[model samples]
Target: MDDQSPPRKGCCSLRCGLALLLHFCNVSMMSQRACLSLTMVAMVNATDAQGLPNASTQEPPGDLRNPVYNWSPKIQGLILSSITYGMLVAQVPVGYLSGIYPIKNMVGSGLLLSSLLSLLLPLAAGAGASLVLACRVAQGLSQGTVLVAQHTVWTRWAPPAERGRLTSMSLSGLMLGPSVALFATGHICQALGWPVVFYIFGACGCALSLSWFVLFYDDPKDHPCISLGEKELITASLPEQVGSGGKSVPIKAVLTSLPVWAISLSCFAYSWTNHIMFLYLPTFISYRLRVDVRENGLLSALPHLCSWLLSILAGHAADGLLARKRLSLIAIRKLFTTLGLLLPALLVMGLLYLGSGFRGTLSLLTLTSATLGFCTAGMMINPLDIAPRYYGFLKGLTILIGMTGGLTSSTLAGIILNQDPVSSWFKIFFLMAAINVTSLVFYLIFAKAEIQDWATEKQHTRL
Candidate 1:
């Protein structure tokens, strides 16, 4: 149970294979989520020379061959946030189901549904903004199961010693999705049209779901292709309580736990800033810097790309520190969480003073994203540390609470920008800084890295 023990060899084990697949799963899911951010620039009509919609003037359709709607900033914000609304509704139910069902089925089905939805998005957009919103919400509902199921997968496969690296590697796809999607969406939209973005990403999602069903197994013991040594290593490394036949989740205890709330608050702050960046940074670059779609895509992607790389590195560093016993588990969580939240806040605030210097602005945004990556080692993975048995459910609960920030941030940014797109950014970034500091203080005070008592307590009541 001492997780400080050195990790065994066999980097190519079945669990590692699962981690890779999980990485691709996140990539596919996020690609679906992010493709719209850049695609919308091309999807909308009546844009000025800067490619942003002219706030003063509204125009009708030009070409039906390469169709573009006349959705306002407020409507665009609603479309962007609709997915989170669906996610909020589905997360708790799916999280609970993940614990009771085979994770492979839950995750594969979710991705498949979302892929089918992606293929339909172009048609939805063609019909109207309302239809597009409906499509996004449905896609959100399907993808909602993904992050929760990811936590469930790790509960069965990731050994405590290797948890940091394994989970981080898999979750890095969350950032990588936006990076790849944004970069590719720009060129794809420009060349083939915005609809092609959906078709290509949808095809990729279908392929990934097929691969997942063929290769992924809920438990090592269930995997037919796993080597005996690898299976034994994974099975032995897991806690005895995990995957032991199901017991009722202690809902009251979980809801009342301060540590749970701590994680939730941290997630809220993180999701807020993260959503703002991925969802709107392209608009910001276009509106403020006056860049073309290709340049806008490349610039917007740089931050997420840096964040993805840094997340993988941070995971390795966190595991190494724990292995060497250089820091207590709680200390490591706090350290990384602080670095993740605090630095980004400071950098975001610095953006207030930088007067249109493209390099300075891009550097700050990239550093903000890169530092935010450290949270993958912090509150992001704390559910497994404290409640491995119910991590999926706990993650569901926290994400439900946390993703509200995504909804709020996107909608609020839309409302604020609706007032004045250029001058109002100061309000958005300042709000982000304040929320980050407040959440960090709460998390540092209440977050725990040890197993909770209720997590181990057995309850005979069945769900």
Candidate 2:
């Protein structure tokens, strides 16, 4: 996997970075949209009347308190939870189609549609909760293809040895996206209004969409900005995967493959803890540990920051190991992914013993995110390892699978946190630990780096 020459300077890599930055912007908007409760809590919680926070003392609807959509906990949860439904229904189909169309078109055009949907949120909310739910779901449908579309670009853009770094770099946007959402939404809510959150982010998405189509090409050979020599390098680097972009996907084989299942389930386990902690950590810090709500808000950001920094670090390290030939790809992926899962599991286990030592628990919780991020090198990059050409579909499948785990974890959190006992919280953390262990076992047993036969042009459709 060693390269004949060092990677070309400031061509595809730069374009890749900018494309992913746009992707992160869309993700940030979605995360902000889902957690409308947080940014608009000031407006919504103005009265005790059905979840409004004293609308009488606060300014009128158009005056001081505005984001009145999330006025009830039930409606807020439903509105927040509805986007996943769209993604669940759309991802597999979209993943398949991304290979057939220009990936830039898929990403750029799709994201613009989602942004436009964001612009409609206020109107939708003004109409009714059902209208708002429909709007969010439509946005999710537009974005459901994003995972596949992003990975499809990487097939042509990233070399085998370089994929660990490049894919990680691109995918790390997942972390950076929410981090931006959390920070940006907070400031905008205070300065402008809750409705402006949708407007501003939606406008940014449209802007990024224009740049994406203008700056990127699905294949290096197709990029006007790329040099002949750089195009030659990329073309030569991905010999097996070249020209596989338009090949038909072998759906039956994909659905039945064992390695696919292993990776997908492993991803499920990782997503479970990650999303649950992200959604509930603030509540745990504020209510369980009795930290002031304002301080808890700031502290909740620590885990995401840790994951973002660690993921970038792990990406470089993984690529370096691949280039130096110090370890096999399987070994390197296992090492990184196992650390991502096992270390966090151990930390969660430790939380059970901390009792009420709130400071220690917060520190451990933040540390868990850093370890969880090691998956960027491990399972996150596995799609490229197994089938570079079909990476979009494989990656989409893994994410689709992970959504189930996310739902399960979220449900468990709702039940346990509602019960509100230190011991009940302990059981949930222990469950997260056990799930991580199960994923490690599955990955160790079944994961593979070699391309699956069904994805090969010559040997496709075995199923």
Candidate 3:
């Protein structure tokens, strides 16, 4: 199939508008991660008016406490950890369902659930850490389902030639969400209490979820406003099996595919390294760089802004290369994947070795993250490359594998920094560099962009 030819005709403008749907979805759900982190920072340094622990005291704040001064670090960790656990448990089932059912409904419900849960976070915390953990877990489960289902849904909507551009544009919300969340949440914390963080994000989620149901459709065939020409263009451009493959799944073939493993392993590595930045970078800056808490959000958002802009450019570049037939799909995917992981790995080491002043260090880290953004053009688009029919399922598998980065990387950091996290920054940076290198090796050896035979061959479909 000619996956990279110019469009024969323009699709409905609404088709383009549909990208904004996921764009908003990405922004709303992804914001929660950074928002909660910002809130945690506030709570950690908070002390009561009387110098006791109290969440209610702004005049004389107290540390995060059960009553007025007794919150345990262990409990804090538990509340955060539950979300990861929820994501791990629900991803497979959600992925499976998205492929067979109406993905719009699944994704919409997930968003709605997560938004509602966000509203309850402050209440859950008031009840105690265990209750808070449960709420976070619920949020995680919903988010996992919604995010994994995205490629599956996009598979139906995106033409093969433009997949990278469209996907990246939607995924750009990932970058924008945290960038805004950190800064906005920080400022909001100063003016209002921490609970407002949840309320604000929750409101955004609620609004976007409503927009999704109204604007989104499962397939081009189902869109009420699609013109005949656009509908034909979309349907003909799509791989045949996408509409048909869900009825039968080749479990063993998919599970054992070398490309799948390569993608999964690479995802694991990327997630591990990125999770360090996502979850711990703010903490690291506060303790090691001696940044003030109020400014942490704005500073932390810098890398994300760099990443967001770079990813947009990378996506257009990848699509342009394919459209011009300047490179084979496999070569394009491989080259960019290498660029994404390889440069970041090396630059991160440079960041560690240079020990440049704060500005220089931030510049290097920004460049490294910008390099990582190229993965938006590479592995992030691979499931659509190989398995349009089962794209969601494959995406779910990779994400499930990738999320271990959350548990494993953070746990490693905890162990390595048992004495003092500030002093242990070198170890953390080195570990991230090593992970990036390992993922690059695995990807170079095994990842493939060609459609797997099992995707289209009926004889193997039932396994």
Candidate 4:
């Protein structure tokens, strides 16, 4: 068995199980992340046209009758954006650590810690806005490790040919989290109170942490239950440099790599649009469409669900194309990246003209999100292609840079919406389109899918 060997046959492969568990890990993290977006709606006291509390505003269906705060738009923005701030601080360090430590411990402990924090979120909300912001930041810090660790895991488990599907399946949980959270949060708040949303998701995270500890091993060779054949297939499929085991990161080389920067920039562009949708789509539906909370939850979930499904399909498509030799790896990466960014850019712009037509707006947004799925086959997985041995460090570094987009988008969107929730949306949409186009051009110019020379053991030894 070697990199060029035919694909393994089996539906019950251990690597697939790894992907499945990683998917659940992602789902748990994302559900916690999305809880605040819709829960905030219920947490805040309804305001009138003049920015004063309006007791007459009708409560949405399933009112939990929880206490509401009067936090301003700017403050709410700070709270929503607070998680990214923590993520920025933790990403690189955790990424570097993933290469050195047992991934099961790092991921399991982080998620467990985050889950515990989620249980405190309702209490924090009751104390003050500042406490809530701090709590969210802590959650962000804990959850940050999960993403980098996921890439690190695949660096060991995924063969080159199966990389697209495996990584995409795991990554799809990013979208699934929101889809499930948004749909459930509204209903949960209505039936069980807003606090229950955090409690429920938090418990799920704790259980997932336990499962990861019991079942996951950092390397296939270390897993007691993986079959000999499946282990050999995974081990042989990885590049020699990666299979040789972890080495010190080539810091200078990674810093100067254009492909690395290209991936980071594309991630930034993608995160900008994604964070806005995740954190604010419910708000947009509430303000623009005047939908009730139940409808808002369902509507907000639509785009993310579409994205989840499309990412899986796109992953398979990318692998299929590679198997058929229909295009070079670079060509497939570029083509899919183009579809992901360009189509979303155009469709987001289309939102500016839709006014209050719920159907049209949702349609464009769903299409936009669905197109973003293509990136799972593009730059999202390119880190593995270019530097499988250093994937943890690269994933961390790139995502640290990329998450700034989330920080920037959330903060700026908050400021913009603070001015006039109605008119300010146009600026947000236009700005999103502009950023997407700019990043897509840069990625097209610099991105490469081949393993870099510096990523090889010989180059690493020289460094």
Candidate 4 lands at a TM-score of 0.94
Q: Which stretches of candidate 2 lie over 4 Å from their true place?
A: 1-7, 10-37, 46-70, 243-246, 289-296, 355-358, 419-424
lDDT by residue for model 4 (39-70), tens: 87777744632256634345543344576777
Off by over 4 Å in 3: 1-12, 46-69, 244-246, 420-423, 461-463
Model 1, 1-463: lDDT tens digits are 2333343454666688788888988998999999888887777742732336544343335544457776876688788889999999988887887888888888899999999999999888878989989999998888998877778888878888888899899999999999999889888877887888999999999999999999998878777877666667878877553642367888888888999999999999999999899798988887768888888889988999999998888888999999999999999999989998999999999888766688888898889887899999999999888888788888898898889987899888878888776678999999999999999999999999998888875644344
Judge candidate 2 against the unseen true structure and give its global Cα lDDT, from 0 to 1.
0.71
Predicted candidate 3 versus true structure: per-residue lDDT over 1-463, tens digit per residue? 2333343432334566777678779888988866776677666554321133555544343334222224555555555566778888777777777778887898899999999999998777677667878889889899988888776766777778778877888887777777778878877877776788889999989999998998789987787866666666777887553643346768898898999888888888877877777777677667647766568888888888788888878888999999999998978888888888888888878987886688877888778767777888988888777777677778888889988876788767756655565558788888788888888888888888887887765634674
Tell me the alpha-carbon RMSD of every candidate: 3.8, 3.8, 4.2, 3.4
The whole-model lDDT of each prediction reads 0.85, 0.71, 0.76, 0.84
Positional deviation of 13 in candidate 2, in angstroms? Answer: 4.7
Q: Candidate 1: RMSD over Cα atoms?
A: 3.8
Assess the local accuracy of residue 429 in candidate 2 as a C-alpha lDDT between 0 and 100.
Answer: 88
Higher-ranked by TM-score: 1 or 2? 1
Task: State the weakest 10-residue window (summed lDDT) of model 3.
Answer: 60-69
Alpha-carbon deviation at 297 in model 4, angstroms: 0.5
Q: Estimate each model's TM-score.
A: 0.94, 0.89, 0.91, 0.94
Report the C-alpha lDDT of model 2 over 1-463, residue by residue, as the tens digit. 2223455653345445654565465455455444453454544543432343456444455563354433565455566667767777777777667767788888888778878887787778778889888987887777776655777777777767677666666666676655555555556666677778777777877777777778877777776666566667778878876534457677788878888888998889998888767666755665557643235545666776777778878988998898899999999988998999999999988877766586787789888877888999998888778877677777778888887787678766666654655577778888999999999999999988888887676855521
